[model samples]
Target: MIRSLRGRLFLGLTAIIILTGATGGLLVYRWAFREAAELQDSVLIQLASLAQNGSFSSGRPLLGVEEDTDVWLIELGATPRGPADDRQLFGLKDGLQVVMRKGQPIRLLLRTRPDGSRFAVAQPTAVRDDTAREMAFRTLLPISALIPCLMLVTAIVVAHSLRPMVRLAGNLDARRADDLTPLPQAGTPSELHPFIHSINGLLVRVGLLVDQQRRFVADAAHELRTPITALSLQAENLGSVDLPEEARGRVAALKQGMQRTKHLLEQLLALARYEAAPAERGEMPLIALDSAVKQVVADLLPQALDRGIDLGFQLVEPHMVRGEPVMLATMVRNLLDNALRLTPRAGRIDIGIYRQDEAAILQIEDTGPGIASPDLERIFEPFFRGSSPEGDGSGLGLSIVKRVVEGLAGEIALENITGSDRSGLRVTVRLPLAADRPNEVSGAA
Candidate 1:
């Protein structure tokens, strides 16, 4: 009924130890009791032999043969001498017998002398039983003491034996969601080999399934792009044809829809490609962090001008980070696009890139309505727009940005910039610096 393996093992072991100890203790006690009784009878026999040999006079009783042994020598002559109990004992043949004397049970050893006289060595039955019981209990002292020590050793051994399982659980819990590495079989108990092997096989199958899904998404997106482009071209061609005002409006809306669809397909393709890419640091090339940020901002400059939003770098420093250049560029573009779409006309967006703590840090701050607190946790989820989403965004921007950042061994954090007269979202990214970077310090521009 125990739910935990440790509890069950401990309880089972403890029960076995207790049962074994009890059984062994009972056997030893019984054997020691019998031996003590036999030995006491032999002592009485030896005392009776000594009395028959005339070693001592029998007119008086002998006492204290040894301390704590209440054996005594009684002279009962050939016939009964004193009490009726003694008379009854003298009438019996020579040897050991149990009888009542003075209304108390006694163990009497009877013997006849060559002179036609008789004497007996008698001991109280209670005293004999008490001595035997004490000796028998003494025999169990070792086993009783050994039981607890055995239980302690059992507990220690159980914990030690189950430690590997505990460590395995912790390792699995700490692993990344996408990590498909097999559990190591080394140092594990042979008994658990089959279980671990099955788990590794499951991981391999799951990884394959995930890779296949990614490829399907990428392939589907690639196949859809050509037709979507052709449709967009057809819509663009309709722009030159002379059409009524109502038809013109319809054509314009169609063109906008096509543009949105194309953007969605592109985002999907990027997401699938990034997810499918293996996260291998050695395969990634070093890229200038500032240069990438500057290029993305310049590309969006026209859109910023059209909206009168001041999109420029507040701080720039020469720093190198390890990542695929295209993926890095995609990440920057998505972040900036999201900011541009949210910020109103005349809004300001500032970008900062610098080296901090052996990492390349990129910070983007925008003068737009900050994201709601409840939406922050779910913002990075694919196709998850906030409650008050703006523009025709595909909602994959932040998701792609998150994937790229994680792929490059970096961390991204988003927070609302709070202070007096300020309400905007601030994005901070920290990526591990590439090796072989110059030691020269570069001032922020």
Candidate 2:
């Protein structure tokens, strides 16, 4: 029932350790029991020898043997003429014997003295068996103590062996969605090599599929741009021809529709361009982020003026980030364009560029309604305008911004700025700072 591999392996090994220990302990106990019994019998034989050689009377104190057990020294006389117990002892020959006296069992060692007098060394049978069992139990101490240490060692080895797999999973979880890099094989166990190989194969196939999709989108957008432009020109030409008021209105609408279509195609092409990483990424020089935002603002200034919307930088600081010029420019343009579309007349758009830690931060805040609560989670999806889409917005602006930011190995986050009197959306971007070269790059000022 255990779901974790670690639990299963540890338990299986633990069960085997316990089972083997039990079996070995049982065998050891039986052997020790037999050895202990034989050893006690030899003690009786040695005691009998001392009695016959030194000669002792029945009244003598025990020969330094156990005082608690029922041990006895009995003289059967030379003729076996005494009590029934003495008669039974005389009936046996020399050496050791187990016999009954007074209906109780005893271990007896009988030997003949040089003077022809015979005697027996006797101890209770139950007492000798108890001593043997206690000695046997002592033999199992080492094995009982060893089982827990083995289980501890097993747990440590299992965790250490599986650490690499845990680290690999964590690395995959933290990567960007478009990342298709192969898993590393160095330092991994040979047992896991086949699994890693399968995953790397899958990544290669996925990368190829994605590249084909991007190429298809780029080609389709290129093929459509020419016809859309011709249609726009034709509509413009028809506008100047003398026509009724109703026809003029229809012609104007036609031109507007054509313009929206043209913008969509341009946005699609830009997305395709930045969706995959460019080869020039490795050779790109450090460029000034403040200057890139400034250029995009200049290009959009005329449009802002037409709408009476105030657009300007609140703070500009020199910060260098590594990326191509067009990529940065496109990124800034789409962000500003989205802001301009949502901001009403007399509203304000603020841009800031500065350094934070090892990253360059580009932030834009606008005086427009913040995004809907339900849409924030899914706002970056392609063509996912919120519940109330406005103007000629293609909804690809944010999606393109996301792709460009990821391609540059940067992070972007959009949050709603809420206050009692005013509310807006704040877009924050953090790009890794390249080696600073402020003097090498020209300023936009």
Cα TM-score per model: 0.78, 0.83
lDDT of each: 0.87, 0.87
Model 1, 1-445: lDDT tens digits are 6799999999999999999999999999999999999999998887787777766655344544875676777778756778776687778888899988788888988888888888888888898999999999999999999999999999999999999999888999988678899999999998888989999999999999989988898999899999999999999999999999999999999998999999999999988877876569767766778877888888899999999999998889888887887888999999999999988899999999988888889999999998999999999998999989888899899999998898888999999988898889999999998875455322112
RMSD of each: 4.6, 3.8
The TM-score that candidate 2 achieves is 0.83
**Native-referenced Cα lDDT, model 2:** 0.87
Can you write out model 2's per-residue Cα lDDT over 28-122, one digit (the tens) per residue? 99999999989988888877777876555673546587776556777777887878878978989987889998788988888888788888888
Q: Which candidate leads the pack in lDDT?
A: 1
Off by over 4 Å in 2: 1-5, 53-63, 66-130, 167-171, 236-257, 280-282, 372-377, 386-392, 438-445
